[model samples]
Target: MLADAEKNGPKPAPLIEAFRRTWGRMIIGIGAALLGVGGFFLMTTFIISYGTDELGIDKSVMLNATVIGSVVEIVVLVVAGRIADRIGAWTVCAIGGLVTMAVAFPAFWLVDTGKPALVYLGVGLGICALSIPYAPIGAVVSGMFPEAFRYSAVAMSYNLAGVVAGFVPLLATSLTGAANGASWGAALLLMVIAACTAAGSFASGSLMRRERAARPAGDRVEVAV
Candidate 1:
């Protein structure tokens, strides 16, 4: 019967074994997380709109916030990498996402004041806090596998997430009703973005935890080389 063939299908060759044993579930979880990362960039468009229309910030303030935020993101990521060994990747990234969302409120609030200068500090911090944990996510994915399959599995998950992250902005804009609410609505929509990140992060951490628990406590298998 077809059911019998499906159950007793030809065994995969060694080359394909790696694929067969691949962590498809884990990869999917991270790819979803990447959607939010891509979404973060999408929010930038709204950010610009908020600064100019709501906050009445001059072009210079917006420019400065962006430049400063980039610089800080680089610095903080370096620091985050060093501490990852102690805390584990999921913990660090989850915390990073939370902190990023926590600070986003005030960062966007400056739009109400219409003074872009007031936002530089918050934006810089927001970027760093939000972005630093992404580096650890790839490592987390790699850790789930034996050495042999680690490379492809890890790369697949991380790259897919990046691709998803690219579309986040457009998604956010549409969700927030960019045309209808304009500046004030854009600010409010940031909360939705934060919610997405929180949900993604929660699912990622929980799934990793489940995987970790599934591994035999005394039978550690190094990632497939």
Candidate 2:
């Protein structure tokens, strides 16, 4: 099974085992993360096409969420990049989990505010929370194996994720329909995506953290690579 196989140790040849680790986790994590991200596009598409009725907002205000989210992504990317460079991927991922937990809570309150701009603020924070840990995930996947199989494993994961990315808009649309047939309602349904991310990612990060932490304290993470 994929789960059992993922938990297994590295092979005698580091490259082979590294291929196994990256193969199982990378495609799954990236696809899921993108799909979750694709939810933003979905929300925008729906709101742009459908309009925000429940919130009494104009189309221009709704677009601000994207603008704000872009800014948020920049902040997250810069900070996460530094952390990934310094602290190791797994620890960053774990910390991201805690940040996600805190971020998700505000979303619930933002919905009640009924101001589209405020909602955008909360959404921006959520996007930032989601993005900050992403740097480590890719690095972890890329470095899992020796040079031999790294290309194959990493490429396969990215390609598969690209394939899966196409399906996100459709799935997100369905989720919107299921959520009271309104675009804003989609936010509630989207939380499920976040929940799954926390579970699977925390698992991935925790596993890697344990593996990396087993090394001597003075041994730097880069040296482990």
TM-score leader:
1
lDDT of 1 by residue, 1-225 (tens): 346558887444533554578656445446435523653574355566556654467867777777887787678777877666676666666676666567656665554455555677656655666675565656655555554555666666666677766555555556446555344444444445554555555566666666666778885544311
Task: Judging by lDDT against the true structure, name the best candidate.
Answer: 1
All candidates: TM-score: 0.68, 0.65
RMSD of each: 6.7, 7.4
Please identify model 2 stretches exceeding 4 Å from their true place.
1-56, 108-113, 182-185, 199-225
Candidate 2 has which clashing residue pairs, if any?
none
Q: Give Cα-based local distance difference scores for all models.
A: 0.58, 0.56
